[model samples]
Target: MSRRSEEKLAERADLMVEEEALRDLAAGGSGLVGLDGPGAGTAAKSAKAKSGGGRGGKEKDPARPRQPYVPARGWPGAGGGRVGYMDPPTMWRATTVQACGMWPFAAGSGSPMTGVPLGQHLFTGATVCGDPLNWFTRARYISNPSLFMLGMPGLGKSTLVNRMLIGLAATGVVPLVLGDLKPDYADTVRALGGQVISIGRGRGGINVLDPGAMGEAAARIGGDAGEVLKAEAHGRVLNMVAALITIVRGRPMDDHEQSVLSAVLHHLRERTPPGRAVLLPDVLRVLTEGPDRVRAVTLDRGSDTRYRDAVDPLHRSLLGILDGPLGDTFASETSTRIDANAPAVCIDISGIGEADTQLTAAAMLAAWSDGLGAVAASHALADAGLAPRRWFFTVLDELWRPLRAASGIVDRIDALTRLNRSLGLGDAKITHTLKDAEALGTDADRAKARGFVERAGMVVCAGLPKTEMEDLGKVVGLSRREIDLVSSWSSPPGWGVRGEDDEPPGRGRFLIKVGGRPGIPIKVAITDAERELHNTNTRWTTNEAAVERAAARIAREVARPAQEGPPPALAGGPAALALPGDPGFPAVEASAGGWTA
Candidate 1:
């Protein structure tokens, strides 16, 4: 009720009076309101009357009709509004303008609780989900540059790997399983698809393949099977000797020591007339030319002349046998072509000691990689003779450290990584700890594991204990949220993620990192159909096929009368039988005791 308040009230009253006059004038506003010039101002203000002014100070009727604004029933034109905000983010796929903050919906899942909204019909032919993105088709195993599967025991890794490989092989994709497994795995592989090697026992290796005018496999070995074996064995032996020396010395030998050993081995193989290779000729060539020569030239300068003299003769004899006898058998033998698109080739070195495992692992990995590389190269090769082959991921499971003896895995990783990509092959290596990986390098380099994980393009971490999770986080560059996903405390089948809508990463859940694309967590399809197609668990029932075939054959024969017509009938019906109580025909089912008879 102060002066300012009174003035505001007075002003409001005047405004109402003017509004009334304006309305009244508007009804028939043409005449008086159009007074000329100065007079018009006076006419316009005719209703600007205060509470009481001039003509009367007495209060007007309290309930006098007062003009009210129609559209003006809005905010008062007094002060400006204070800034305000919107509500919290509640629904997924909700609008951003009215949002509080968003939490990730379940990533790449179709579970009622976790499934994120999909666009529609992206995967045209896929039948699983109704998502428009067509995740099934787009995320298929074929589309990926490579697929990698890693799991703890009983997680069904090998089961799926073998099954899927077999199925693919049957498609004429060519499947070759080179791993440290007994005949059972091979048998299972064969049962699902392509032929398997019979090297172990009678199962026999793959039959000689018609490489279809592509002598690619033969070219690698130079001439025949013995040559290939010899080359592989030589590399393996050299690798083994290196590991043995490393184990004995507690360290890798210096360049000089290596040189001396090489010289001695070389001297024995070449200085004598018996040095002509009788077995693995290719291997003998590689050994004598580069390896032993380098050693002889370098180490002979020191006190290693005696070493060379002793080992040289035996080396030559072995090389000669490898060149002659060994080469002959392999030359006449045939080759087997397995699938070039397997997801894994498990190289189990369980029985071997840590030192020997290094040699075997290196040699085997090298061989598989070379084969895959050859396949891929053949495909991309511009030559008309070369057909591009589809290569897949080469995953190593149950990876063991070579007892601080073998050598730097970094070198192997580097070589493999280069070759893997060149041949369209991916490498997924599984190890228990970061330290274990670190130990595989000879130079005590810390970045060995880091370099590997970084180059892998995709790194999937599962069942990580807390401590190991922390350690992995440091090297893997995973964020706090991503680390949480990896170290999830939830039981199997839960998933955790960090990006847009994070959740617990669970069993059958995997995160893919494709080049520069965002990490996509996927709920893999583990259905029976998928398993049957990918892993080859579905067996062909010969009995059922045979039954159908037999029925059809029998029907056709019966309808046409295979005997040209019906057999002789009982001439006078039942009375025509010569024997008194003879049945015209015997039971076919029981005839001669079996169908064949």
Candidate 2:
């Protein structure tokens, strides 16, 4: 456009703003143009007189200002009232700009004040940039550093992730899975070209990290605990390790350096002992590999440093993990050709409980962290622009369990959130119990979890119990009436998907958020084996040991019913669903002593 055209547009915009301001003054005392008293009107007139114009020679009615804007503070709602915002002569559309650029602010549209476009959001896998919630439309969100996924059994946390992989597989972005419980699903992941090693399973498998491991790993190089590491102070060490990793990037601690750390830990143990300690395999790996293994680096002077140069090389490795075999291994798969496709990876955690959850989660987190570090160091982790298209997702169905495990897990997780994103690695954590999240991890881990939820680029809640409804309502800035919308995942199709959108239709409905919007309601699909996501549901009856146990249980309980009751329509306890069906509908026949077949 010509300069004259641009100037005309600017003038029009200014006129509109001035008109609105004067209108606001006439309408209410609280508007930006509001009058404090009758004297306020005289003051304005006097100012205009001093300027030699009542209305800038434009329109000479008794009201309205000649200038479009005038900066001043101390006004209500201008960063002074109960809920004040920045004090400035902001454009009317300023909210639109600020809303889009800021992270974790109360959800709102973009502001002209900040001039950031409130564009849709997408997920950034280790090597790709795209939307994580692809199956359900209208919930586009830019991949923020945080993501929260909640659901009950069979709620598609895994399945949807697979769809996400399919959507962005070409981007070469990949993720490191932190905690996928069902090792049986390894094949599916391998098909995606991801290199996954299960930790906490056995000796050959990655061992579940433990506090003892922390102490052992530390002492291996004959390092001192600038403070000693005690199990009782697990949480502190976990936080320290996490804080240190973010600083050190997995650099190794020299012998004397170890001693200093031990001393620092020992000092903290005496002065402020933690409730528990969680041992992270990643931390152990750093100490074992001697620090050249991990990525982030911070000198220990302020926190202490210069022990060994570990973080820089670790950062280099991260680029490889995100771009190489590990990237594919951590993703979902469609065929035996591991590199050909990337699939969403999710694990079913219906049967696992807290303390027992550590091992499984460690496995998944380990894989994910490795992949994310690689992605961040190279191409995928840039703060601006789209993630390089290659993307992979790891969905943790019951994440809180592992986080709550000994204190060591907390910092490791924070490290995941703090450092892992951007390289095409997205950690999708689904939980039934925020309380589990609240109670289990060290205070630091719990804080990290909460921080994640608060700043999530996208958040969806469905079918929550009432207490959860109340708790989340406050967290997301929802009203009491909105709280009633939450329900369980087991509910029908769209029952409780509530968030920044209109009441979504169907049972088990969910509200979807994208960059400060509550735009639409969406459905969280259930798992049917035929769907894209590989369901890691195991049949106890199908297992050799489980089959033997069920067979034995059949001998003791569940007697053959008399002629009175109808033939059982469904599968039985001792005879799990995996058993062959009596499809012929043959008449009842006895077996063994009860009756000969």
Best by TM-score: 1
**Per-residue lDDT of 123-198 in model 1, one digit per residue for the tens?**
2211122110122133432232333333343334444444334434443334444444222254444345433333
Q: What's the residue-level lDDT of 170 in candidate 1?
A: 42
Pick out the ten consecutive residues of candidate 2 with the lowest summed lDDT: 111-120
Residue 342 lDDT in candidate 2: 33
lDDT of 2 by residue, 1-597 (tens): 997786667666556655766765675422343334223455666655666674455443466543323333223333442212446574232344666665354544331111112212222111112254332222334455345766555444555444444334434435434455553334555566555443332222321122333333233323233123324234433333333332223233344444433443343334333433322323333443433212122343332134344243433443343343333322122111112123433232223334443333433444433333333322322222322334445555556656654444555556656554533455566666567767852566677777767766666665666677677766766554445554533344444456443332323344454554442344434334424236456543256887789898986566645435676666654445443455543356767678533
Judge candidate 1 against the unseen true structure and give its global Cα lDDT, from 0 to 1: 0.41
List candidate 2 stretches off by more than 4 Å. Answer: 1-145, 183-187, 190-196, 200-203, 206-369, 376-394, 419-424, 479-482, 488-508, 524-533, 540-597
- Weakest 10 consecutive residues, lDDT, candidate 1? 125-134
The global C-alpha lDDT for each of the candidates, from Candidate 1 onward, is 0.41, 0.43
**Compared to the true structure, candidate 2 yields what TM-score?**
0.41
- Backbone clashes counted, model 1: 54
